[model samples]
Target: MHVARHKWRSSKTAQRGVEELNAQVARHEGRVQIVNPEGLHPLATRPTLREYISQLWARRFFITADARAKALRTTRDYRLWQLWLVLNPLFDVALYGFLFGMLLKTSRGIENFIGFLFIGIIFMSMMTGLMNSGISLMQSSRSMIRAFQFPRASIPFSTTLRSMIDNVLPAIVALLAAFLFQWGTWPSWTLILVVPLFILIHIFGCGLMLITARLTAQIPEAKTILGLVSRGLFFLSGVMFSIDRFAEHSAVHQVMSANPCYIFLTAVRDASIYRTAPSLATWGELVAWSVGAFVLGFIFFWRAEDKYVRLV
Candidate 1:
């Protein structure tokens, strides 16, 4: 019994000594960081925001190549290839024109109804496409995310970049069509604003991609949630008809006006169709939405950077 007591006291003394040593070594915490000096074990922790941003920038080339490959893969399977970009929007115009313009007569008092519909459908495609791009990436990219030792944020960023590449031609076509049809101010300088608007939409899409990518990774059902949200935004954004259909003081008018999607579409329509300079208020709202979404989404995604592989 005396020998056992001596051993137990020795064990307690050794443990206290080890704890003191560890506390001394750990400057910020009362713990120990075990470094495998033999280089057999590599230790990595979630990077600081500054380090995360740096890592993302360093991998920009990889992201670009991935985006390029994705963009090419999408069209490679289709016989019409890139022509589908222009054709798809035209087809939507025809279909929606028949459904809403003729059947529902939603375009009754709206001037240049074709142009209005064209601008709404073509421009709003970015929002819907980015949404799908964001949500679907979580499932489709599981293999790449698991096999690679990369920043998972790269996946969504590349998806957003891919979207921007696919959108360029369609955007140019929309602008030209609206101008030629005299749907917007034909000789207006405000059309130049579409360039900035395009970039703004890209940034906003990146934000959405980051946000939804993380959400869908953590929760498989977020895809369905995002779909419902997309359909809701579609109706609220006034894509097929004017929000003026709602009374000025009604709930929809208030909500649509405040909605980021609606605000973005309104700004683009002004630049693309009306030939009028977007009001400062419009620019302000656009800037706020685009920048705010991107910054917040990136941070949100970054917070769970270490868990992506396991979550998906």
Candidate 2:
């Protein structure tokens, strides 16, 4: 009887141990309850839109500094250094002027054709630079991404900022060329509008860069495709010719006129060349494009922020 009792006790102890082990395993399988001041969050996932923007804002200083650094780095090693900034645009203007003005005679009807062409080339350069930089933005920042924890949007934003800075010398040269070529008149109060218009363009470029950066990150091959597409856009953007030439084709005219490059070039020409404030319609369009693209691109990029690291 005593032996039987001992066996029964052993069995009960073993059963109790098994039950304890199962309880522990079940508790571990339940949802993780992380406790911290920053709140519980997954490391390998994207933040909400609101949170992402907030994080980006927090790093604004970094963006500006990085942009300036990049701008300096790019020109530092060049043979002509900063001179290329002005000379490059001048060369492009001369080339396009020959093609469209001399060969095609597209500039025959336009008043101050030189000024119009200058503004178009300089402004379009900004757009092209933004798109091109965006394609390599993620790849360029792979090292930074691995080392730091910051918004990926900052890379594209910094790129746009660098482009804007690089254009300062070119813009001055273009303006001077326009005036010398009789494309622009003396500065007036209307010229002040260039400041605001440029700000809008910068915003628009930032948004576009964001979208392209995300796209290239997701699909590596998109870089080559985007380069070709951007070249085609240069022709369609009315950089070398007036959109009015297409006035008879309502569909084509509307498409080209609605292009952000065309809108920005027109605004610059109106302010500097025509000595007039951009019309309310133009202002509305610029604002709409800038705000819409920025919001949409930010959200789109932030949606895949976590994935960027994996892509590299």
Which stretch of 10 consecutive residues in model 1 shows the poorest summed lDDT?
178-187
Q: Which ten residues in a row have the lowest lDDT in candidate 2?
A: 179-188
Per-residue lDDT of model 1, residues 1-312, tens digit only = 999999999999999999998887776655657877888753335789999999999999999998898784566679888778788888988999899999999988887788788878887888878877788676787898778777778888888888888888888777777666773346468778988998998898788888888898888888898999888887678888888888766886787778888787778888767767888988888899999999999999999988877787
lDDT of candidates 1 onward, in order: 0.83, 0.84
- Write down the TM-score for model 1: 0.83
- Clashes per model (N, Cα, C within 3 A): 1, 0
lDDT of 2 by residue, 1-312 (tens): 999999999999999999999999888866876678676676667888788889889999999998888774566678888777777788999999999999999997798899889988888888777777788788888998888888888888888888888777777777778777773358778888988887888888888888889899889899899999889888888888888999999999998888888888888988987788988988998999999998888888888999888887
Model 2 regions lying over 4 Å from their true place: 1-42
> Which residue pairs show backbone clashes in model 2?
none
Model 1 alpha-carbon drift over 4 Å, by segment: 1-44, 183-185
lDDT value for candidate 1?
A: 0.83
